[model samples]
Target chain A: MTRRSISLLGVLAASWWIAAPTGWTHRLDECLQAMRVNVATDRLTLDLDLTPGASVAGQVLALLDLDADGEISATESVDYARRLLRDVAVTLDGRGLSLHVVSADASPLAHLKSGDGRLRIRAHAGWDALGTGTHVLDLTNRHLPSISVYLVNATKPADPALLLGRQVRNPHQSEYRLEFTITRQDATDPSPP
Target chain B: MAVWLWASLLGVVPVLRAAESAAVRVTQAADAFVRTLNESQRRGVQFEFNDAAQRTRWSNLPVSMAKRAGLRLGDLTAEQRAAAMNLLRAALSERGYEKILGIVQSDEVLRRQGNSTVPFGQDEFFISFMGKPSVSAPWMLQFGGHHLALNLTMAGDQGVLTPSLIAVQPAMFEWNGKTVRPMGRETDKALALVQSLDATQRKAAVLAFEMRDLALGPGHDGETIAPEGVQVATFSAAQRQLLLELVAEWSGIIHDAAAQRKLKEIESKLDQTWFAWSGPLEAGKAYFRVQGPTLIIEYAPQRLGGDVTMHIHSMVRDPTNDYGKQFLP
Candidate 1:
């Protein structure tokens, strides 16, 4: 082969080689998108959408490797898990919401389980005032290295204007973004039914 | 030149791949232990697997016998409980496994002492394994219920099993007219190590203020203070041995080879570390502390249940490795 043709072939092969992993990863993204949160309630749910074929325990180990140490022993795993679960970010209309995350195997207030080929996460959000106005409930997954959130509001709102939220999901990392808007029955009313 | 670079890169890949394989093996061993459990014992293992959901609410401690076990032993059938214990034995050292059983039996002793109703005191033992048991990946073996919390982590070439919070109330209870001191020996060794230090070393080691417990609890962020107070080099030979003994009590919790490597790392830094104590050394009063390079051990004796001098709290931590130091970079 001519030198010019040989060089061109090498360039093409290198480009394909680098592009292969990204293409494969895109398929993984498609699999995760199938596990988005389509249901809504007064209580917020944060689903840990594991990648296709990824074991729940394995995914947890990967998330626990916050240091990207390539390996996570028992001590590091628990510490990372504790820190990740403890530091989860929950915001309501730009204000930080106080909530607890427990083991799915733990209490009736919070439920955790794996079914339908995904690790289902359900958590309750408490509010002191439920006024007849739009309120935003935002949840973020701080642990997963590369996963985006696709949120759908299962609870119908009184008005579309109350849907004051945006979807800013980032794939290739574990930060799923979702927002919920709660509208009161009346704009001036302080009570919520 | 290009060929050489590629060759070197390829050479490194196997090393990395081999390490990953080793990690998988470790995980499989842990999995084997889990797999051996009957549905009931498996349930006990599952109860403490705190995922994102359960952490959101204030859950109560395991109050009932069934709840405490997280799985009823009766439900396991005799064969399953034996299998579960065997799995534990396989995963831990003879000493390590025995210590766990001893601690569990000790908890039973405390429970039988009529101290069951007290809130925030010693109760049942809860065990959870995080990460698959493997030599390569990180994993944890945690056994803690009520006043006892043992957290051990094994990573590549290093293991940290500390912040081991062990507490015993009414330190000694009369069981069939015999005084039983379940957690006394470990405490006494630690206290003796502190007392062996010279006046100058003692002055440097003892914190000006006594702490009820190690300030670095589970959720605390960042290193609280620079390595200060007493240095191990200041101790005499006998005192240093005592210090090593004190640290070993916690290191002994893990049965893995990595535990010995961790002990050696702590031992090599013996001279640079410090041993400190607080409170009164007497049996009735609360007081004790030990600090070293890569190690911190603390103990406090307190009153519980109508002025009974029975409550105790102790903890061990690695200065450089707590929580994997994951916060860095």
Candidate 2:
């Protein structure tokens, strides 16, 4: 291994010495793939917080560092985020939604190797105003499933008119289904979507 | 109780000093604090304005885990300790000062319990400064230890209190015959707002999943998560009034004038604000957040110490102006 890579390995080992007692953190050996889904009146947002375990940091880094120069550039970061999102499936009422990258950031290689870094990707899909009525939204994650552990949650809607119902997740949390109803003020509002 | 009596005797209970702006009061109090310290103590607490690392060194952890950059309050003489509190009183509102004192005294309670391996209590708290105390030049006052951190940045008449952590252990305790809860108002106000929501509103207000801790607390600065929960625009006028009052529990912690300005900024963007909660209404052990275009406030009852409500962590940050970065060069 290169000296830089060796230094990272040392940092990763040292990270295990300190136990952080704050927030939602994954210190286990599996890669943590957590997603927060927000459904609004006009748009759908998916915020992903992906962190690779110390033992598997090398594999994750290789996937992010396209040029393998030991660093992830801005362009490379965006490209990797887009590539990951391709495996994600977001659907509303069985209609597949097209998501565009809103923001993407890859943490420094050293930080990632030490298990403290997170690759945050935010993707959004905007559509014409949804018709007022009950709707079903389904999300599936197929990104690095073999080595990844998944956590998916749907946020409370931003519009008070949008009432959320029970959420169902698969055993592995790779598949999530959300039920919601949009209550508009008047019958003149758009028909059931 | 003795500390409160001492503060009263010192005549520095955040009463208005005629014609003095908040910034002037803060700077004068800071200078006076420095004057009371010895040369070594001064060196220990002072830092250059551009010391970025020192500015972010404040943490809600024990001193052993996080080496803070300042003179420990425990190490100071009684006179110096009072001076330090006077500086805090000058920088915070009267209620804010009381809350902070309550948090510090809570640590002393922990020390009395003597269960932990590491040190705990008021003596572990530190007060540090970045840049000279000046009403014109930008400077920062950093104070924190165990479950509390106050980072106030000031310039001229402007002051920003962001990226601060307010937490307590034994969230409720008896102090001189009275029950003291440092974060009590924040808890009660939020519970009131959540309970006031109707069925449909509550359905939209609470999260679909559990949120055991803060989403944007310390170490997660400058990040704006997608706003979740019921929008403030949907609230009735009475409900909106309660929401504004809830927001004040955090924003109003700063000195009066600055707190008012901050509240006004928040109110102007009321249409964009969102309140999200996770956990049952009756159970006080819940996580709630008030997020807006400029403000993010999170309160969570930590799961340690058996009773969740006994250990709590709450954070307030202005995404646009944490550490007063907007005004700095």
> Native contacts retained per candidate?
0.00, 0.00
Worst 10 residues of 1 chain B by lDDT: B53-62
Task: Please list all clashing residue pairs in model 2, or write none if there are none.
Answer: none
lDDT of 1: 0.49
How far residue B44's Cα lies from its native spot in candidate 1, in Å, is 7.0
Model 1 ranges off by over 4 Å: A1-193, B1-32, B38-75, B115-123, B155-158, B173-180, B221-223, B226-228, B283-286, B305-309, B323-329
Across A1-193, the per-residue lDDT of candidate 2 in tens digits comes to 9999999988876674333232211243567787777777677888888878667788888889979998988888888899898999989989999888888898888767756567988898776677888888998899898878776766655466877775766766788898878788332322112
TM-score of 2: 0.67
Quote the positional error of residue B202 for candidate 1 in Å.
2.9
Clash statistics: count for each candidate: 42, 0
B-chain TM-score, every candidate? 0.71, 0.93
State the lDDT of candidate 1 residue by residue for B211-254, as single tens digits: 43333433322333324357777777888788777777776666
